[model samples]
Target: MTWTFEEMDRMFHPRVVAVVGDKKDRDYMWLRSVSTLKGKVYSVQVNPEEAANIVAMGFPNYSSLLDIPEPVDYVIVAVPRHVAPRVLEDAIRKGVNGVMFFTAGFAETGEPEGIRLQQVLTDMARKARMKIVGPNCMGLFNPRWGLRHSPEQYYDDGGPVGFISQSGTHATFFSLVGYQHGVKISKSASMGNGIILHADDYLDYLGQDPQTQVIAMYLEGVPNARRLFHLMQEIGQRKPIVVWKGGQTSEGARAVQSHTASLAASTALWQAAVRQANALWADSFDETLDLVKALCFLKEPVGPRLGLVAMTGGQSVVITDAFAKAGLQVPLLTPRSYQELATFYSTIGGSYRNPMDMTPTSRNLDMVRRVLDILARDDNIDAICYEFNMGFSAREGMVERLVDLLGEFREAYPRPFLCVLSAVHREAEAVGVRQALAQRGVPAYPSFQRAGNAFRKVWDYYRERRERGATRPAPAPAGPVRPG
Candidate 1:
């Protein structure tokens, strides 16, 4: 339908939303999902029982989209597949800006009827110049406006990340899991069986979205590979785009067709395309969030040289190996940095080389602060990683103090500083500490491997950005991206 950016924006930030066929049978799922939306919500149900129930829920009930008094900005169609055409006709007649077809049984079903129905709706929407999100997908999630695809999704705590996924489950999971890990989203779309609107359309819109600073994508496949790749190259130059392509394997590709009717590309071809476009690639959900967290929280790391701080000698060796294996350098600190460390750096059960083993001395906050200061000033190091066992830190009553110290270092230093909080039989305590660190603008991972991997992705992104002369000014230091 060739929707304008403004039109898409309004659809995302709708003033009025309508849900069709939200009945007690499904527990009024679609209606409840949009309950937190900061706009008028109407239920379109022809059934008298469902209408009365929707009224009891407080949202006004209407027989059809045309019966609604207000102009519907967005419509969620949850009617049966056979009834979808009628709803779409009504929606088009009502002049709705967008309709997200949450109803399944479309082309993904692989039946002729299903495919024909999909084409029918596609033609209708295009003829009427209507914007449709998905006939088999989860639609838009705008946290800022509390427009959500699921009731469980967070609201009113928007961040700088914009996510696009083909699978509805992946979209919902990304928002749910990403939020707990400090990767709150600005806007996200689950574009299932993207018939009328392609993934490139969402990418183009998000690329220009002022609220979005980093874009994350979960793609089963792209219908127009060339256009998608071009958008990646153009948009990625401005904002980092992290892509996690599903259907990389033969089995996954077979599943992708049935799941979204998508044509999965060869893994080699997809990887090469992503690298050529200078877009980051992630292998799984965790990696996607990890990369996003790093991109959102960390400053632009100028080099691969990483300075490591571990509480124990074994940890130092392990983390060093982790980072090095992740394609990051654990080079020796400059002579000047070593000379400064020699001043009060005791050699008792600790070493102050690259991965400064702060075993016994780590208990002393002053010594930890000094070590961080030394690393921050060292030219050989572009990023810093500090590892601590959360269980021990809490027992020593140093969690709060360490978080504050790290917060200070984060603010004072331009280098990207991260913390790896090992659970060590205290997983709950580790989560609290990680949250605290996140609140103070420090990216904390559960393990050394995660910390190193996330940092390496950020490093690769910045390095590519620099090489392309597309580097933007460093983001201002801030707490977690979530709004207070």
Candidate 2:
């Protein structure tokens, strides 16, 4: 059965969240930050000394989960591995529905005792009909709710893209990149070892989450292949799922085995999983994030017809080639759009064909805006792709001009607009400019190749959703789309 917003909402925005374990300085900060977003937090620790400072950070301190006066909706356990089962039992007796075990040293230790411990936890959870997030994991972070779980303080609030990663560092890095790259998080969880809750659980949750527009995963190997495949099939029908497996090489596979006690499984099985789930296999973290970001913003391109507009034909030719490599259609501009853009600038020496290159001409906001407007309005065009680089023309408020052009284009055109601002700019300026552009519903990337790849994914997602006769959840008026 498909999960709904009302159901999923309770999972993230729980009425009361109880955090178990002595609050270390780091863990306390993470807990406090997340508590700020929504919900009341009951800090549970055995030691009153440790809980004292944590209680001061805007949460009530309790000796144990059962001691909390209010009903705890979610519990995050960060105690020693040996102490976890007891704490989990307490949480269960207290009727906690969800628990995220952030402590490590279960199965990942590669000892028989560790494996046994994990199995015990799993068995207890199943018998209790309670859901466990992780036993050896970094845990989850939902920016919309102010969760920064790990020591990683990255925040990508209200973004449509959601991530599930095996690596804690990957979880932290990707979230940082999502913040840096203009991608937002609906909800992100790092399932370090699939002791109890596997990737499939979070995948299923994100599939049903109203805030999540697209899903991305950094998988080492599938924990429960059968369940994952079924979940993927169902989730893929509604939204795009991009996965980047880490254990590809023999050495990498060995690392994954030791890191998470994850079996690499057969290559054939992995390949089949990709196809069966209808999931896109991304090559790297950048590609995974780029594609997810694209899917979050752009709609399906009508056809392969990509209308490329750049400051120069060289840039256009480069983007066209990248588009082809990314399996995108590079449709030539129709006569109407071509003629409309022609009124604004000279074509110089190059042919005035599709990748409309307004080269050697003064690069002004009106010139770029008119080109984007005309191309986006074209009946033959499916989407508009443009490139802008700093130092090429930074004078005369170039950033402001680009931002204004993006604003006007969004107002005039209804199709997806993919922009590539490949150069490095000041962080403050870039953030302001990007925020402005994103406000108008445009998706921007750091490079032309990335822009092309993003557009391709967006097109695929749009097509996939259309084929399934599904509609995207109505996104709230937020910069990043968050699944409710």
Candidate 3:
């Protein structure tokens, strides 16, 4: 079936749901799945005795789908693979719209019989024209609808990010990480095996999803390469996409086959696709979250030139190298601006060329503020990175001063300001300061490389967006390949 934003809305936000399988002890579905659903939910257990206990605990249980009085919009199949086909048959007879398989032992098992059973389920689903999420997946997790994987997990009422991953853990990973780091999320889904619904389908859905402005994905492989590339190009023009494509190496590719029973596209082709779509590619999971923070926290930077302030002169060298390698510029200040900066201090030991050093002289909070204020006004500087290391041993109230200064800079300046914590972020005082800054929507990095990389991604996105003009042009169709 064709995919669209409205179709996604109707399918994911279903009115009625059925959990078809053997009931687990303590009613796991009632606590984790059914309790979270914001719609009418009923479970179909084959054993009448277990069904009685399930209904007694909390959720309404049924002996079979045929006995239920209301129509089922979605089904979560948790039975064994051998029993799944019959459940699908029952669902089709009952006119179910979608199914998410919480059961494994299908294609991922690397057995011929499992593959055949998966094919049977796929054929039945095709004839019925129903969307299937996974034969080994956790399905959809949406905060607006209160859909989640774990009962203890917290869902942000309405976040700004829509995430889809091949692994269920990655979906849960983002939610846990986002909750602690202040990264708001709208949707997190694990489309396991991706047999029926592909990753590109979610891209189309998220591209027009009004609640989501940024899309993040963790992909192992795509069945239709051309479709994925075109869809990414279409979505990239409207919203930014941060993708972490797995199986880029020979070893990783072998692992991919066993993991999902899908072919791993060559790294060269995958990178080309990412470049063609003008989407951001991440090397590590931390970097993936880094891109999310950059997109969510900082505004678009005007240029790539960065102004660095440090706690020590030695740290300046490290910060400068990191910035340069990350595709950012550390430009030399004009002689006039240099001389104006020298007015704040003596020219003997103080250096004012660029990355205005505040470590040499004794720093009062006001003087440091003026120095940053001066650098922020310069046309040569598009973004500012300040290094702060604090001690709470009555060290002249360093933590408070730095926190206050950061707040003021955030209020006064329009450019993106970064806090470089170096190795000091591990300190107890620094951790407190970091959280404070993050709460104010200010980004604080533990090291120079991370800080530089985050800013570079932010710059590249805005620059590309600017060059492409205000609107992204739709791509022309290529031969016989067209978006389904």
Task: Pick the TM-score winner.
Answer: 1
By summed lDDT, which 10 consecutive residues of candidate 3 come out lowest? 475-484
RMSD per prediction, one decimal? Answer: 2.0, 3.7, 6.4
Q: Model 1: per-residue lDDT, tens digit, 1-484?
A: 3557898899899999999998897888888889988999999989998899999999999888998998999999998898999999998998999999999998999999999999999999989988989989999999889899888887876878899999999999988877666667889999899988889999989988988888999999887889999999998888888999999999999999999999998999999999988889999998998888888778778889999999889999999999998999998999999999898998899999889999878888899999999999998888899986665575466888988999889989997888888877887666567767777778888778888888888788778778888857336234444422
Question: Residue by residue across 215-320, what tens digits does model 2's lDDT show?
Answer: 8899888757788888887887767788888888888889988888888876567767876677777878888877776665664556667888766667878888
- Cα deviation at 380, candidate 2, in Å, is 5.5
Q: Tell me the deviation in Å of residue 409 in model 3.
A: 2.6
- Could you give candidate 3's per-residue lDDT for residues 121-167 as a string of tens digits? 99998888878888788788776676666564564354678898888
Structural similarity to truth (TM-score) of each candidate: 0.95, 0.86, 0.86
lDDT of 3 at 312: 59
After best superposition, candidate 3 residue 81: deviation in angstroms?
Answer: 1.2
Sliding window of 10 residues with minimal summed lDDT for model 2: 475-484
The number of the candidate with the highest lDDT is: 1
Q: Judge candidate 3 at residue 388 and give its lDDT.
A: 71
